[model samples]
Target chain A: MTTLLVVLLLAIGVYCVAVLEAWIASGRFRLMAPACSAIALLGRESIVPRKPDLLFFEMGPIVLLVAALLAAAVIPLSPDLIITDLATGALFLNAALAYVLVALIMAGWGPNGAYAMIGGWRFLGQLIAYAMLVVMPITAVAMRAESLATTDIVISQSGLWNIFYQPLGFVLFFIAAMGLAFLPPFDLPTAKGELAGGVEAEYSGVRLAVFRLGRMVLVVTLAAATVTFYLGGWQGPSLPPWLWSAIKILLVTAAMLLIGRYVPRIREAHLLAWCWKFGIPLALLNIFIVGILLVVIP
Target chain B: MITAQAIFIGFFGVAAVWFGVVVFRTFSMVRSAIALLFSQTALGAMFLTMQAEFLGVLQIMMMATEMSIMAFFMVMFMMDPGGMGKMEMTHQKRLSWIVGLASFVGAVAIAVFIDWGPVATTVAETAEQTEALGLELLGRSMLIFEMAGVTILTAMIAATSVAIPPMPSPEKTHKDKV
Candidate 1:
C-alpha cells in the first residue's frame, strides 16, 4: 500500500516537473505534452549499436528505475506512511542512490559511442566531485537529529527546519542534490548541445522512455530528499501530513528544475576542486555549529 | 517470521555465492566487475537478515560506488574492455581446480569442526542498534572513523593531482624556443 502511494506520488511529481520545465523552456503551459512525448517514446524502437555491450544496454535503464524506487522506499512521506522504515533510512537512501553512478556508467558504456562514453566518464568525475557534498551535509543533519532515521531527521526540523537551523548545510545539500540530478546547469551527462545528448545519444524507444523516466524519478527523489532534510517535512498546519509532503516535494522539485536554467554548467575540474576544498570544509563547520548549538542551547 | 528470516538469509547467501562464481566465469572485465557488485550486494542483504541494519546499508552503499571506480580502472587497464575479444580469465586449470577444491574443503571442515557457541536469538531493535552504533562511532571508535575519513580524503587529493596534468611553465616554452 505504501509502495503504491509513493509510486503514484512520484509519478505525479515527475509529471509536474516536466510541466514546469516545459513552461520554463517555452511560455506555454501544456499539461499533456509530457504524456504525448512518453507515448511517442514507447512507440520507437531502441536501436542497439553494432558490437555494443548487450547486457549493460538492457540493464542500465532497469537498474536506474530500480535504484530510484529503492531510494523512495525509505523516505517517509508521513509519520506512519513510510515503507520499511529502516534504522539507517537516511544512509539507506544514500546507499540505494549510489547505484545511479553504476547505472549511468553502464548506460554510457553500453552504447560504445564516443559521446556516450565521454558522458559516462564525466559522471564518474561528477561522482568524485559531489559524493562528499551529498554525504557531509547529511552528516550534519544526522548530527542535529542524533539519529539516521529519515523520520527523526524530519522531526528534528519541527521546531526549526534544518534550512533555518543550519542554512549552510541546506544550501550545500541543495546544490549537491542538483548536481546529482544533473539538472540543466549540471547536466553534463546528457547535455544536448555539446555531446549530442551525451549519454542519451544512443538510447531510443521504450528503453529511452525508461531512461528518461528514471531521470525524472531521480530529480523528484532528490527534491523529496531536500525537503525531508531541509524543509520541515509534513509539518505545516491546515493540511494533512501526506498532502504537506506532496506539496513540499513538488515545490522543491520545481525550484530545483527552474534554478538550473539560470546557471551555466560547472566545468568538471572546477567541480572536483570546489567540492573538496569549499564544500567539505563548510560541511565540517556546519557539523561544528550544530554540535555547539546542541551543547550551548540545551 | 523466523522461517522468512532464514529464507532471506539463505537466498541472499546463495545469490552472493552464485554471483561470486559468475565473477570468475565471465570473460568481460565489465561483467566481472558488475558480478562482484552483485556478490557484494547479496552479502549486504545477508547482513540485513542478521539485523545489522547499519552494517548492511553501509556495505551496500559503499560497495556500489566503489565497484564503479573498480569498473572504471579495470576497463582502463584491460586490453578488451568491451569483451569483443574472448580472453581467458583463469590460467593453470589443474592447479586452479586443486586450489579451489582445497579451499572449499578446508572452509567446510573448519565450519563443521569448530565448537560454535549458542545462537543469539534476540536481537536489538533497529533504532537502539543505530543509536548504539552512533555512540560507538562518536564515542569509543572516534579516532578510527576520523582516520578512515582522512585517508579517503588523502587518496582523493592524490588521485586528482595525478589525473590532472600540471600546466607547462612559460620559462620552459622560452627555453625550448632559444
Candidate 2:
C-alpha cells in the first residue's frame, strides 16, 4: 500500500511538472491545458507504419516508461517513503536509466524510415558524448559519500551539501542531466525542425503519448536524482523531508525547462566535440580534486 | 508447493532461454538486437532474484547500451533493414544443431556431476559486502585495476585514430606557388 501511494504521488508530481513545462515552453495559458491535452491524446487511434518492425516499434516507448519508473523507484521521497533501499541504489538508478538509450534506438530503428534511423543514430552519438560526463561526477559523489547507496550519500551531506564541496561536479552533472533528457540545446535526436520528431516521427495517439510521458518522467527522475545527489535530498529543517525533496525537485525542473526554452540548440558536431574535449576532462578533474580533498581533509 | 523465489527463478530462467532462441531466429538485425536485449533483461532478473542487486542492474545497463550500439552497426550494414525481404542467414543447419545439442549436453552433465563447494557460512549484510568489495578492489587489486583502465583507454585512443580517415591533404591548388 505504501509502495502504491509512492507510485501515485510520483506519477502526479511528474505529470504536473510535465504540464507546467509544456505551458511555460509554449507560453500557453489554458488553466485546463494538461487535462485537455491528455483527453485529446486518448481519443486518437495509434497508427503503426506499413513496414514497421512490429515488436520493437510497440515495445520501445513501454521500455522507456518502465526504465524511468524503475529509476525513480530507487529515489526516496522521504526517509520513510523509499520504495527499495538497495545498498547500491545510486548506481541502480544510473543502470536503469541507461535503458533509455536502448529504447531510443528501438524507436529510431523500428519505424524503418530514414528520419527515424537518423534520430536513433543521433541518440547514440548523444549517449557517447554525455555518458562519461554523467558517470564521472556520480563517481566523485560516490567517492565523497564513500558508499554507492543514495541514502548514505544524502546522510553524508547533512553537514554540508555536496554542491558546496563539489560545485564543479554539480555543474557537470546538471549539464549531463539536460543531455540525458534530450532537452533543448542537447535535443539532437528529436530535432523537430530537422528530423520532424526524429525517433517519434512515426508514433501517434497512444504511442506518441507514451513517448512524451516517458521523456517527462525522465525529466522528473533526473531532477530528483540531482536533488538526491547534490542538493541533499529530503534533507532540511522546519519542514518534513518529503516536502523538502518535492520542493527541490520542482525548482530543478523549472530551471531545466527554462534553460531548455532559452538556450539555442547546438550543432551536433560542436556539442559532441565540446562534451568529449572539455566536459569530460573537467568532470575528471572535479573527481580528482574531490578525491584529493577527501583524502587530505580527512 | 512452489515458493515465490522458486517461481520467480523458473519464470525468468525460461524467459531468458526463450528470448535467447528468438535472438538467433529473428530475421532483421534490429529485431535480433532487441531480442538479445530481452534475453539480457531476463538474465538480469535472475540475478536480482539472487539479491545481487548491483550486479543485476549493472548487467542490464551494460547490455542495454551495448545492444543499442549493436543496432547502430546493424542499421549501417544490413541490406534488409526492415526484415521485409527473406534471406538465407544460416548454413549447415543440421551439423550446427548437432553441435549445439552436444554443447548443451556437456554443460548439463558438468553441472550435474561437479561437486560444488558449500555456500558461505556467513553472508555479510549488503553494505558490509559492498565495503569488502571496495577494499578488495582498491586495497588488494588497485594496481591491476589502474593498469586495466589505462590499457582500455589506450585501446580506445588507437581505435579512434584508426576509425577516422586521415583528412585529404588540402588538394594541391594549381594557383599555389610550389
Candidate 3:
C-alpha cells in the first residue's frame, strides 16, 4: 500500500516537474505539453549506434529510474505516509544518488561515441567535485537531528528549520543538489550546445523518454529532499500535512527548475574549483557551527 | 524476522558469490568492474540481512561510487576495454587457482575446527546500534579511524601531484624560444 502511494506520488511529481520545466523553458503554461512531448518521444524510433554496448545502453536509463525511486522511497511525505522508514534513510538517499554518476557513465559509454564518452567523463569529474558538498551538509543535518532518518531530520526542524539554523549548510546542500540533478548551469553531462546533447544525444524513442523521465524524477526527488532537510517539511500550520509537503516540494521544484534557466551553464573547471575551494570549507564550518549550536542550545 | 533475514541473506549471499565469479569471468574491463559492483552491492544487502543497517547502507553507497570510478579508470587504461577482442581476463590462472583453493580450504578448516564463542542473545535496534557504533568510533577507535583518514588524504594528494604535468616557467619558455 505504501509502495503504491509513493510510486503514484513520484509519478505525479515527475509529471509536474516535466510541466514546470517546460513552463520555465518556454513562455507558455500549457498543462498537457509534457504528456504530448512524451508521446511524441515514444513515437520516434530508438536507433542504436553501431557497435554499442547493449547492456549498458539498455540498463542506463532503467538504473537511473530505479536509483531515483529507491531514494524517493525513504523520503516521507507526512509522519504516517513514509514508505519503509529505514534507520539509515538519509544515508540511503545519498547512496542511491551516487549511482547517478554510474548511470550517466553507462549512458555515455553505451553509445560508443566520442561525445557521449566525454560527457560521462565530465560527470565523473563533477561527482568528485560535488560529492563532498553533498555528504558534508547531510552530515551536519544528521548531527542536528541526532539520527540519519529523514523523518527525524524533518521533525528536528519543528522549532527552527536548518535553513535558518545552518544557512551555510542549506546553501551548500542546495547547490550540490542542483549539481546532482544536473540542472542547467550544472548540466555539463547533457550540455546540448557543447556535446550535442552529450549523454542524452544517443538515446531516442522510449529510451529517450525513460531517460528524461528519470531525470525529472531525479529533479523532484532532490527538490523534495531539500524541503525535507532545510525547509521544515510538512511543518506549516492551517494546511494538511500532505498538502504542506506537496506545496513545499512543488515550490522547491519550481524554484530549482526556474533558477537554472537564468544562470548560464557553468564550465566544469569553474564548477569543480568553486565547489572544492568555497563549498567544502563552508560545509565544514557549517558542521562546526551546528555542533557548537547543538551543545549550547541543548 | 529471523526467517526474513535468513531468506534475504541466502539470496544476496549467492548473488554476491555469483557476481564475484562474473567479475573474473568477463572479458570487458567495464563489465568486470560492474560485476564487482554488483558483488559488493549484494554483500551490502547481506549486511542488511544481518540487521547491520548503517554498515550495509554505507557499504552499498561507497562501493557504487568507488566501483564506477574504478570502471572509468579501467576503461581508460586497459586495452580492448569493451571486450571486443574477447581477450583473456585471467593471468597466471594456475597460481591463482591454487591460492584460491588453498584459502578456501583454510577458511573452511578454521570455521569447522574453532570452538566458536557463544552467540549474542539479544539484538540491538538499528538506531541504538548506530549510536553505539558512533560512540565506539569516537572513543576506542578514534586513533585508527583518524590514521586511516590522514593516510587516504595523503595518498590522494600524492596521486594528484603525480598525475598532473608540471607547467614550464616563463623563463624556461623564453630560453627555449631564444
Candidate 4:
C-alpha cells in the first residue's frame, strides 16, 4: 500500500510539474480541463528527420523513466515505508541518475544531426563539471551520517539538518543539483535560443512527450534527494512524517523553479570553469570544516 | 506479493521482447544506432533493479551522451548529396551468424559454470562508517589525489584555449619595391 502511494505521489508530482511548465509556456491555468487538453495537445505529430532511427528515439524516454522510477523505489519516504530498502541505497541512487547522460547521448546519436551531436558534447562537459561537486557534498553528508542507509541519514539528523552544519556543502550540492536537472543558469545544453532545444530538438510526438515527462520526474527526484539529504526526510513537528516529506519536497521543487526563472544562464565553458575552480574548492573546504567541528564539538 | 512479482516479471518479459525486436529490425543505420542506444539505456535500468544505483546512473549518462554525439555525426556528415541512398549496414552472408552463435554458446557456458563467492562482512555498516569514509577521503592520502583532479581540470581549460583557431594573417599588399 505504501509503495503504491509513493508511486502515485511521484506520478502526480511529475504530472503537476509538466502541466505547470506547459501552463507557463502557454500562459494559462484553467485547472484540470485545460491541463488535460494541453496534455493531449502534446501528442501532436513529431517530425522524424530523414534516415533517423525510430527505435532509438522511442527507447530514450523509456530508459529515463524506468531508471528514475527504480531509483525512487530505494529512497525511503518514512521509517518502515520504503519499497526496496537496499543496503547500498546511496550508491544505487547515484548509479540510476548517471544513466541520464547515456539516454541523452543516445537521443543525440540516433537523430544523426550536427546540433544533436554538439548538444551531446555539451551535456558530457556539464556532467564532468558537476558530478564531482555533487559527489563531494553527498560524501560529506554520508560521512556525517556515518551510515550508507537513507533511513539512518535521516535518523542522524534528529538534532540538526546537514544543511545547518555543512552550509557550504549544502550550497555546493544545491548548485550541482540544479545543473544536473538542467535548470536555469546551468541549462546550456538545451539553451533553446542557441541550440534549438539542444539534444532534444529533433525528437517529436510521443517520444518527445516521454522525454518531457522524464525531465519532470528527474526534477522531482532531485528535489526528493535534497530533502532526503539536507532537510531531514520526513522529519518535522506536528504533521505526519509522509506529509512532512511531501511538504518539504514541494518547497524544494518550488525553489528549483524559482532558480530556473531568476538565475542568468552562463556559457557552457564558463560554467565548467566555475565548477572546477569555485565549486570544488568550496566543497573541499566544507569537508575540512565538518571534520574539525566533528572532532572539537564531540 | 503476487503483484510485486508480476510487476518484476512483466518488466523483464517486456525488456526481452523489446531487445529482440531491436536486434532483428532492418532499418537505416541511423535507426539501428538509435535502437542500440536505447538497449544500453534498458541495461542501465536493469542495473538499478539490481541495487547498483551509481552504476546505473553512470550507464545512462555515458550511453545517452555518446549516442547523441554519434547521431549528430551521422546527420551532419553521412548524408548523400540530394538525399538519395541513406548509409546502412548490409547483411553480410554467414559472417554474423557464426559470431552470434559463438557468443551465445560462450555466454551459456559461463552462466552454467561460474561460481560466486560469499559476501564479506564489513565494519563500515556501523554508525561511524560515514565519518570514517569522510575522514579517510580528507586525510593526507586522498588529499593529493583530489588536488591532482583539480590540477588536471585547470590544464584542460588551458589546452582548450590554446587550441582555439587563431585569426588569419593579413595578405601583404604590394607596397613600394624593397
- For residue A216, model 2's alpha carbon misses the true position, in angstroms, by 1.2
lDDT of 3 by residue, A194-280 (tens): 999999999999999999989889988898899999999878989888889888999998888788989999999899999889888
Candidate 1 chain B, poorest ten consecutive residues by summed lDDT: B82-91
| Ten-residue stretch with the least lDDT total in model 1 chain A | A257-266
> Against the unseen true structure, what C-alpha lDDT does each candidate score?
0.87, 0.86, 0.90, 0.72
Q: For candidate 2, lDDT tens digit of each residue in B141-178?
A: 99998999999999999999999998666655533546
Which of the two, 1 or 2, has more DockQ?
Answer: 1
- Give the alpha carbon lDDT tens digit for every residue of A13-56 in model 4: 77667666555556676557435744674868877888664555
- What is each candidate's fraction of native interface contacts (fnat)? 0.83, 0.80, 0.86, 0.29
lDDT of 2 by residue, A57-151 (tens): 99889989988998998888888788888888888887888888988988887877889878888989898678778788999999988888888
Clashing pairs in 3: none
RMSD of each: 2.7, 2.5, 2.0, 7.0
| Superposition error at A142 for model 2 (Å) | 1.2
User: Under CAPRI classification, how is model 3 graded?
Assistant: high
Clash count for each candidate, listed in order shown? 0, 0, 0, 38
DockQ of candidates 1 onward, in order?
0.77, 0.73, 0.82, 0.21
lDDT of 3 by residue, B1-178 (tens): 5676678888999999999999888888888898999999999989887888899999999998899889988988998898999986568989989999999999989999998988775589999999999999899999998999999999999999999999899999999999
DockQ for candidate 3: 0.82
Query: Higher TM-score: candidate 2 or 4?
Result: 2
In candidate 4, stretches whose alpha carbon ends up further than 4 angstroms from where it belongs are: A19-29, B1-178
Comparing 2 and 3 on lDDT, the stronger one? 3
